[model samples]
Target: MANTKAKAPPIIDFAPFYGTDPTARQDLVAQVRAACLDKGFFQIINHSVPATLQDAMFTLAHEFFALPIEEKLKVDANLNDYHRGYETFRSQAFSGSLRPDFKESIDFGPDYQPDHRYVQAKHAACGPNLYPASVTNPAAFRTTVDTYLAAALGLANDVLRVLALGLGLQEGYFEGFATDPVATVKMLYYPSQEPVAGEGGDDGERGINAHTDFGFVTLLMQDDVGGLQVFDNDTDSWLDVTPIKHAYVVNLGDCTQRMTNDRYRSGLHQVINRSGRTRYSIACFHAGDPEYVVRCLPRGIGGEGGEEKYPPVSVNDYLTERTKDSYIRAEALNAT
Candidate 1:
């Protein structure tokens, strides 16, 4: 006997969205809407970010992570007022899962000046990022990362415009929410898995616990070594999101789900790096303006005359609560 299940998510091409043909754009919109309603996950191709930039960022990540532990600790994430610096392995645990995730990561958010309003106010998610002095080429690393972040943000804004059109709103419907958005980029490294002693198997250590993104949307770029999985609600099983060259795995987040009154879901995903080689990935998370009040859209609120399914809430408050629960020792919340 053999088992059968879906292994990959739908892959969508963005060419149609950029063409002059109205029909093509409409078709693209339809596809996006279906993907959102079905799995809340999809792979996008033809996004404008350059391959050279992606490669450079990945190289920089490898260099930074390969540094000695002591050297890498100069700018520890724990010491930062805002959660922006290097996080050691096994420092984060999913809310319900007591086991710490088996990976290390570095987090960065919108670059703010020391005297900027948000930074001055000690906003939980806004401040200058910490860069490690131990890196061989600190200048190159910072330049590459900043360039990548800018490109990712541009892509996110475009995607949101398409989504707004898909939902029957003006293309700029989401523009207001994106102004000075809470955009964060995280570089993650998962080392090869090791066999556990006195156990029948590898003990199933997870690179990251199964959970949904807490923002409006997330764009992920993974290396060829695949270990990411998305939970399939309809089949009650996990499906691998295999890496595609030059493609980004896009998925909506809690804010988008709530804003759509559950019309669009926030898929639950986890990472398990079983590949003999180490795995690295960069995730760009975009949420609406922190102070914006999120409520169900008119089109999604009462489809076909039903009542609104969600209550309005502030984005900052919602993200703050979720982040506190996601990390075991979240001193960053004190700033809020």
Candidate 2:
């Protein structure tokens, strides 16, 4: 059972890091390290991304999702080899439950052409993005999204630098992994649902089921409708992550845990939207360069035997295996 007095995720102000004060920078790094090792989650405020841009991205999401069902289907993600387009509502089941997640999404990545190195080599989840040309202003939609993606990538870069420092490495330690990154920006829509009785009397159908992410890190921007919850290992309960205006909810992924040999956690979280209003969120899943090998960092291999918890694996191989498992699980549930 979830605790009635649930703890909220720690909120950190990130703007101070931009100043030239070394103490401020170190303090920010310490906060991030603590969050990663504890809850594996934190909320960031006063970041570089503009508020206007975020609002514009949400507006574009509304515009795209408002299209007719047939119009949206023209870019069905399943039709393409890269799954870079639209994914239908309730088509994904993240927790191995019979009930699929009640959400629809459209994914966009770096618009690589056929001649790009990754695309030419047929890398997993690497391809050009698909935009809905049928929208009222298709050009505006694409342009705004592209701009927003750039902003998200910028924020990710800064966060990665902070993470590197927290891990006791040079700020540029993660740069090698970023060369030709396979990151993605996903726009998700979850419709309102009837409440169900469970862990907290508020637990309901899964908007997104309980699962850990499959990459280096995840950065999410969500609207006012509350549903996101993070599992608290200490209290053995689910805690609500209330939205902070224009703030990003950042979390580590499985790959990060693998790199740290489990010293840092990859927390499990789920969404349950019973607010009687639709929920919209944008998540940037930042995977590293496909070919980079993820090995345990020196600082993390410190058990009695100094052994690594997980063997080294390439980014592509890890993501491919995880992605395959997700699809298979979703398909199995849908078939039931």
lDDT of 1: 0.83
Cα-based lDDT for every prediction: 0.83, 0.86
- In candidate 2, stretches whose alpha carbon ends up further than 4 angstroms from where it belongs are 1-6, 197-204, 299-305
Model 2: per-residue Cα lDDT over 242-299, one tens digit each: 9887999999999998988887788889988889999999999999898889998875
Clashing pairs in 1: none
> What lDDT is reached at residue 223 by model 2?
96
lDDT of 1 by residue, 38-148 (tens): 778999998878988888878888988999988878878878767888998767666555467889999877888789887776655788888777888888777778888
Per-residue error for 261 in candidate 1, Å, reads 0.4
Q: lDDT score, residue 298, model 1?
A: 75
Residue 4 in model 1: lDDT: 49
